[model samples]
Target: MPEKCGTGLSLLPDVPRPNEPSVGRFGEVLRQYNVRLWAGADLVSVTGTWMQVLGVNWYVLQVTGSSTRMGLAMLVQALPVLLLGPYGGALADRLPVRRILVVTQVLHAVLAAALALAVFADAGLWAIYAVAAVSGVVSAVDGPALGRFGGMVAGPARLGTALAFGSLIHSTGRIVGMAAGGVLVASFGPAPLFLWNAVSFAGVVVALLRVRVADLHPLAAAPREAGAVRAGFAYLLRQPVVLGTLALSFVLGSLGRNYQVTMAAMSDGPLAGGAAGYGLLSAVFAAGTVLGALVAGQRAELTTRLLVGAGLLASALQVVAAFVPGLWAFALVLVPIAAAAVLLDTTVSARVQLDTREDMRGRVLAAVGVVGSLSGMVGAPLLGWLSEVAGPRAALAIGGAVCLAACGLAGARLVRRSEPAVPAALATA
Candidate 1:
């Protein structure tokens, strides 16, 4: 194995200084929002859910022995977000977000618990799909509300770093839960893994209940009006900054960082490692995400420089991962891959928050989620078919190059723009 200059991969400026003052000097969000507690609870629940994800997928395949059914099950799980993101965002703006979150968490708890019970009772394949579909709907309602919660937790100034916390917890949670799911499934079976997922949601439910509703700042007057939907769409049309950010986000999510799908295929197809190889691949990629979060946390504010650098590194790493000859080398690339993933994702999220106003936050957040979910929807089938026909390396290499071009364009826009570049209609506050 070639020595990984893992620490020395300076393909881009590793990260940049944040725009905000030091957390301590300005009254850190960690203190003001009690962000740690909320973040920690989400960490536990999401991790458990991720664990259940692996078990559920494995179970679907094990029971049905049909790759088609497994794929459909995955599709069903995400279908809710595809259908409901806009409505969900509207609801987030209308309802009290924290209360909505509590309801969502409880529903997930029930879903997880029911799955564990049904599996224990020897449920069939179709039954499992039904349960997963229901869970997906609940998540569709839950996701935008979760996205809006960031503003409440950290306010505007610390939103960047606070979101970095969510990103970090999300990656770490997935890794921890996936590792546990694999172990539990290997030892006891899918039922036990799901049972623990329910328990994890229980933790989230408790934490959400403890949150002070009074602390949450409400969305303003206009979005609550009757014709807000028309206004929301019109708002984007009028603002080049919002339009461009959404375009960049949609492209990035769709074509930019699909190494997850490609990595699974690569581990077995070109690399010849099979299941264990895929597992190792996921671990390394997740580690890269975690590293990115940590680096983002240290920054007080997100900068345009950091965003461009992260995107460049992400594209460069994907290209290298595609051509890298050996498993060890492929795995080695993940370190920078993870770093760039977090860097690009968190900064993008923070930028969206900065660029949107409080009243439209729900719609704006929901819109971004909708676009991201749509990207995955479009990318999944195309990437799968392309990999099948042209091989995994081609899919990644082409995807990486396209994604890099997107980053370059976005970087140019940022460099040339003199103003803060938020959506114009909402810019008045």
Candidate 2:
């Protein structure tokens, strides 16, 4: 078992106390062995996931030469999450998270292998679509379970730092994976990348097995009950801050963050930089996310003001990026845009996890997942259609404008209310 801190929380020996200086909290949280293990595995897994993403998008475009088709592929993937995410989150609340993750990771691996096989066989577009849908089904459960597990691994006191570290890992993976995928796809094809992803899941499974379960600060598993999904919604309706943040996330995620659709179109169309340009943009954006994560990790607390501010900044940057004349200029603009995107995402996630009750965390996270899926479902196709009609630049500008307006309204509301964002009950929790 981990030793108890002064706050009576179970903390690893390396975890800093609440009263400790916050200057190096980012490094301090990582000193926990389990955190390190989780980070290492997450890096590998996320890298693979990004690699698969690049491969799928590129494959679809190469085959059909349509940005609309690329968006349709993304829409298919998000559909299951939109439909089933609540049930997945409810399952996370009832089950052992570590166990659930192990199963889901295995399923992900199997699905990746299936995609690889389909690619190798020169299967039709339906094969790719089917694999994407199945993967989304796995993700609907995996996302919520993973979110809840992070809290258990780091404990509430260090959760903010831990989540920031998670972003760092994810971004690092994106950098490596996107860069490599670009080079590999140019020389080979998407099949090899899919195979590599299938193998990456082993890293996470091994890490889960190695973790000391006794050291985790797990919440009591909620009992099986009807209306469990509705219960999560009811809980969120009561927390104005969390509910508002989710609403903001839905808009930003749909409009401000459909870069996969936009970037691919820009690369193939106006920029004429092709696969290499898209990869470079993806990598640069991820590098910015790394910087943003490091900055976010240093903070001891997150607030609604910070969340809205980050979203506002990112939205402005998106509009700037839409007008860059050349590929390199576009890529350069993406750096700060991606950084602010990370800040916005990390703030919203931390606020949601910190403000919710332990038992309801999974369900709330599931709702978050559903929002993301719904955003992708709506945004991907819309952006794709817009890119096809007015062009990629117009799609970017319009999306950015919408996000900017939404964030502005949300920030103004926060000022007018002038009430504590964190509820008294949760603030004490």
Candidate 3:
């Protein structure tokens, strides 16, 4: 059974309920009409997003012909999330999430279309950079709003299952979109792929409009006020489990999960596999994430223990990957490494959502977005430099070791902390 916090919301459940349906929890969650619709639309939307991502990266590389410039393009894109994530979360908490989502999706569609037009016009790299920056701003709002909206669509009781399914949807979309984007970009160009992404956003907009408001489990909107974002941080500080999980998430995300940089380095430098090998490794990693999401979706609950354990597993696997003998062996190692990465990611996300109050979920997830952006901004360049200076294998080993240390420290601190996981104010409420 899960423990209820002061807000009367249940935290992570430790076991399956006695009356859980025979069809299985994941299936039961999927049986809901709203869940099905949301899942389907989200799948299409994510697939398109990944396709656009592939197209954008490829276009930037082609225009600049320099990996450093390509990285700068990505960094510009993440800046908005780092700067505006808390405000975005505050918006999610204060307004109707569905409305916010609808608006953001429309903006996304327009932006993608604009990018496609720019590419078709043979615009310079400046157009790509500008689009990426604006898109990031939209996503700063969309990301937190979408996170809270999932809870409403599924309701509180089934949120875990819904989120797991969300992860599965993302991984599936990544594989399909990347593979298709690769083929299409080779044949057509980046413009068509961006247009396809623009169309994809419409699927989500339609899905949102069709969902029944009556079926949702909406929280009372937080009153409009100053310091809402600050209050969100205060709330997080008062919860040990959520804070600890976020800390671990930062470490794992920043250090252990830069597989894009690390894997490319391995392929070109250490593994001697080049572009073909890099593509193979990426595909393999995507398949692994799908596998991990399927396994995670079946679980009845997520816990701090599971989060830390997954991180530890992934860290260990990364270390092992650093020493693999050749390209084939390196590719073989990435499967379990990617699996553990998704499991850690899924667990951390579920824990953050489940442990926070309903009204504050968006803000907390906004914090999550900030952490993610920071990790990418900080980690990518660091790892890239490490790969350059110390060798890709050493970069991998050092990153894994750092994550392993962080996880161990987190686990030890959890054991030593005498306070209950719930905030004292919330516990007494």
Candidate 4:
């Protein structure tokens, strides 16, 4: 109304501007916020990875009807990571992380496709297991490089949030893929499910290709001592912080984590529901994982309190979930289970990222990865055997008890020492 009536002195309507400074153009968001489109694409491909994971486990059980066999199958997948994961991390640091990722992603895609075709063509169980075993070996190389690239893409400033976002995407993908897998198997059998996984691999491959080198530091080859591998271990041994966090990973990976296979058995046997029940159970738990990831992103650091507390909480959740009375009430426990696992993971990874030097990031992460899988290798079979004889509940009970005790003893001491300065942070516990 008072517009520059005569001399451009009119009052203009106030345009709302962001309280924050200009974030620049759309492309700048990815640059400053560490929001890479390729990361999203890679996550989409992981959906397929989770699908194969479900189908393979189900297929093994279908053939053997033995919990031990199911565990053995998992053992095969994780075994390579136990033995070679650190070496994998070392290689990631030595070479260009980007190039290594490209090669690994392609190999992984090929293996996934091969498995799909084999199952679709009526191949044997041995063939499926063989592919899984071989692919597991390749993952030792792929996973560490992939992990390093996460920090590379996001930079150290946003490492925690980036990790959380990746976790969120991956967890959501797993839930969607796992549910789709259960339904697909019932309707068209596992063949098509495997095929879908194969196709999904291409998505990640393209994403990897699209990422620019300008965004990533070249991971050049480094010549270290004869015992370069042991170097990482040596570093960890000196630092109780890393050692304790790693110990927690080992315990959780080995014992506290075999819920998927156990849940499958429990759903069918105790809950008296079939595939639908299994799928629903899986989806709910994955939903918990997604929620945990979201919660993790908002946090600033993975303090000592978080490391120990999350471990204790996870152990307790496992125990409670096993004892819950009806299916609905029982399923609700998965939320905490998922949340605790993410917290545990976030605590450890963020600690490593925070503490490790830039040069050793790959090697240290590799060592962490190995400890994680090896512990799982040992724990999974034991739980499987326990499940077979005493039933799933018994296995869960024992695993849960062991996890809680370990967290209380080892984790408590470590957290107390690491976090005395900020006593209140122990609420993470």
Return the top candidate by TM-score: 3
Which sections of candidate 2 miss by over 4 Å?
1-21, 264-279, 322-330, 384-395, 415-429
For 1-429, candidate 3 gives per-residue lDDT tens digits of 122234334652532463443246567677778889999998998889999998988998888788888888788889999888898999999998899999999999999999999999988888889989998899899989998888778766666566667888999999889989999999999999999999998999999999988877666567899999898888878878677778888889988998999999999997988999998999899889988877676665555666778888899989999998999999888998888887787777776776677778889899998898888888988999999999999999999999999999988875354233321111111
Pairs with backbone N, CA or C atoms under 3 Å apart (clashes), candidate 4: 3-10, 4-10, 94-220, 95-219, 309-429
Q: 200-250, model 4: which lDDT tens digit per residue?
A: 767776766776657653333446557666776676566666677778789
**182: Cα error in model 3, Å:** 1.3
Candidate 2: which pairs clash? none
lDDT tens string, model 1, 137-254? 8877788788777566654445666766677889989988888888889988898888888888778778777877776544452336676656666665665655667787677677
C-alpha RMSD between model 1 and the true structure? 8.1
- Lowest lDDT sum, 10 consecutive residues, model 3, at 420-429
- Sorted by lDDT (best first), the order is 3, 2, 1, 4
Query: Which stretches of candidate 3 lie above 4 Å from their native place?
Result: 1-23, 415-429
* TM-score of model number 1: 0.87
Q: What is the TM-score of each candidate against the true structure?
A: 0.87, 0.87, 0.92, 0.82
Task: Write down the lDDT of every candidate, Cα atoms only.
Answer: 0.72, 0.81, 0.81, 0.69
What global local distance difference test value does model 4 have? 0.69
